[model samples]
Target: MDIVPLLDRIGEPQAAALFGLITGLIFGIAAQRSSFCLRASVVEFAHGRLGSRMAVWLLAFSTAVVWTQMAELSGMMRAEDARMMAVPGSISGAVVGGLLFGAGMVMARGCSGRLLVLAATGNMRSVVSGLVFAVVAQMALQGWLAPVRNWIAGLWITPGGTNFNLLTSLHLPQQSGFVIGLAFALAALWLARKNRVSLRVLFTASGVGFAVAAGWVLTYSLSQVAFDPVQVESATFTGPSANTLMFFLTSSPVLEFDIGLVPGVFLGAFLSAAWGRELKLQGFEGAGSMSRALIGAAFMGMGGMLAGGCAIGAGVTGGSIFVGTAWLALFCMWIGGMATSWLLDQRGAVAQPGLHVPH
Candidate 1:
């Protein structure tokens, strides 16, 4: 789908936004229907639910890996040419940020992507978390907290760094990286086979992976369009969340894919919720829930920026490309999530009468 002529015909910004909208809409629908929440996946695993939803996450991520590689192999898109691949990054930032983001996701009850879907489905808690996540992400990116973020990021930033992944570090062929990614994905599928999985979970996860891969292909095509300054990237919710917020605050006519994608998620979720009769107004349980949400959202926003992406962005999309930072972020996120689950258990035990807290 050569988009150069399309850009020439309908204009670059419109074309990009349209493509983003289509992908985002599909993502939102799949997510809404499948209950695809990374945070939940982690929590369930910690609680011994095993491969049920976790399988969904794995399948989606694996699907993305396969599709993204296909695009690269077919000359439709090159992962190495993406901005995240070109820019210098911090390993410390990825580790620390992922931990923070993971902990926050547990407290907030969802990641930024899940919040967006919930918000569209009339979840007030999600609305608050989504807004806070966007605002804090903006702060970490270039707002009041930017200096702090930069300082921490600079601590581990490597100039002209290579070997951020096993394949690159080992000096192996790129095909080796593809194999590693597929192997992990396959392992996830195998684990998921232990439980009775639903068709909705399978289909939704596959769609999500496809949506992510499509985002890459679409953005790459837009980058090839003449006279347009489209960034070669895929769906990363954290930065895009901030971008969506900024679009409304400023008076610029910059119709970016990010902006279109954000709203597209909401619209798609709204439609799915309506169709499924799942649209219902919900709010925080009390002051405690609200307070937890505030802290969680703040952490997620800052952490996501520091880590370079959120679950979908870095974990699924970036991980699919076999990047070093994405792998570290994913590992640390699991650790952070597990730790938070333990803490939550302790806190719950403490709150109960005649309950003895474990050492």
Candidate 2:
């Protein structure tokens, strides 16, 4: 029958966290196996090569879009109840925040999700960067930097913001939206047809897509629990990272789904790295490198808060749901990342080409 009611009748919050953990584990394992870094994908695409990584990202996005829509149409979920609903769409915020986040990912060498995975695999640089990311994200979301974020947001909020997708704007039936989303997914996969994709990429992409969809479904289900309040969301890292950090530092006994998801990713990645023999102890070069990482992470934290999502949160998860803010942020992040990548190349300071375990 309806598992949502069943789950609510049993253990509510813990069950939600368990679902998030499962999703996070799948996402982590896939990311580790495929080396699915968005920055890396951007760099590969910039080189005029159709990268499977990018394709995987698109696949994940399209899959989530279709699944989420289907769920909504089936009366399983309502996207309007998501956390992003209250946040007014700010194109300026999306563009500037995305640009900053993209540039930061270049310097940090991974988005928030990737950093979580890397940190679990003994990458000290990622550990440091993750900490900075969490702390700064916390600040921007609800701490001292909140005023700055509010001020920026107050400057350029869009009026009459539509639901983050074309389906809603088209005023079409949900089935019509599903068809369109399915077509978009197929098109994205077809465009990546030329790329020499591997089984790992396919598996990783599917896992990521499922994880995103699962987040929506799980959170939506939890929202129906009469006693406990849960927001409808999916696998986003920015606010989750901050929330996770806050959980440990505060006296709250309740654990949200994201807290479990974040740690589960780390655990899965750690195990995957150990299995793959990719795990290694590594750190930044010196004070200069550390300084750069801190600054970059700071940018990501602030940008992620303003844009309302990070790479995975906005790019993949939000994109899956076809949120306009996410789409715009993803575009700006790409531009900002590409510009930074090009600049670093010109300065002869770009990291060595090809992915590898931290040294």
Candidate 3:
């Protein structure tokens, strides 16, 4: 309740920005090294390959759940402290948003995080996707689509209407949710290892999960301190997608950009690319590819808004907390991606020349 002491201890804006930078750096590194992308994973899965991408995603989910639980049990944090848990009706939006985001991500070839990391690595197509995502996200958030979003939000329905985290709705305790999440993470690691994937791949995938969990812990926990009482700590693509666009446009606003997990993710990938010598300025080679990236970015923005998060936001961070909406959003996203892929395949859209795998 009392944040003055906490603020005095950490030094608000500076601490928050620093926290973001560190988290973003780690996320970028993991993403660059592992090529951790939800779009790629879903696409590959649909294409009949049991690749390590999905495993990496699951690992992140499990790690988040376990770490969050540990934090709560140790009195290091509180679940009620997060914004997602405080808004249950948003579950409806999460599902719809996820479905849209999933489809868009598939069309665009990556999610928000992937786009940022890829853009940092000099992938031109990713740069375009990132730009489109940021722009459209802003439009959806406060520009053209705000009214529609608000209207749709007003239509949400649930019995009792109580704010329900996934665990609460399922009649599961916080401890149980943590256990389940950790168990799943361990299982994912085991399965991934059993596949005889290269140690580099294995480490990269697992490390991404750890980085994600650490991001939530650092940001949300830090935000809770008195110095900077952030209402929530989350990792999703939509808000940043919009913020990135705003930052680019209003560069002279002297905008106090809070360095958070997403920025760290971008920095992480930049550093990783630098280390690997993989950084290069690459751009869309085909009109069709550019179109796809634009359309996909729009979809990701709208869908993320509806779903309440993207791969990291809902799929890993929120999902780990067992938010009811996160589960719905995750499945909807998968379905949306699969649906989009199928539609594209039927139209022979995916077979276009220059449409190479990003990872």
Specify the highest-TM-score model's number: 1
Tens-place lDDT digits, model 3, residues 167-258: 76678766897689778877878767766656686567666666655655666666655343465555666776676556667845322223
lDDT of 2 by residue, 147-263 (tens): 998887667776665445545676866587578668877876775676767766666766777777778887877777636677788888999899899888988657678878998
Would you list the rank order by TM-score, best first?
Answer: 1, 2, 3
For model 1, the superposed segments whose C-alpha errors exceed 4 Å read 161-166, 353-359
- Those runs of model 3 whose alpha carbons end farther than 4 Å from true positions after fitting are 1-10, 157-162, 251-258, 349-359
What are the models' TM-scores? 0.94, 0.88, 0.88
Per-residue alpha-carbon lDDT of model 1 for 1-359, expressed as tens digits? 77767877889888878887988998999889878889988888787666677888888888888888878878888776777776776788898999999999989989899999999999999999999999999999989999988888778875575425546677988676557657867776686667767767788877888888899899888887648466777777999999989989998857878888999889988998999999999999999999998899998999999888998888888887777888788887888887897798788887886776443
lDDT of candidate 3 at residue 116, scale 0 to 100: 87
Candidate 2 Cα errors over 4 Å, as ranges: 4-10, 160-164, 170-173, 187-193, 286-288, 349-359
The prediction achieving the highest lDDT against the true structure is 1
Better of 1 and 2 by TM-score: 1
The models' CA-based lDDT, in order, is 0.84, 0.80, 0.72
Model 2 shows how many backbone clashes?
A: 3
In order of lDDT, best first, we have 1, 2, 3
Which one wins by lDDT: 1 or 2? 1
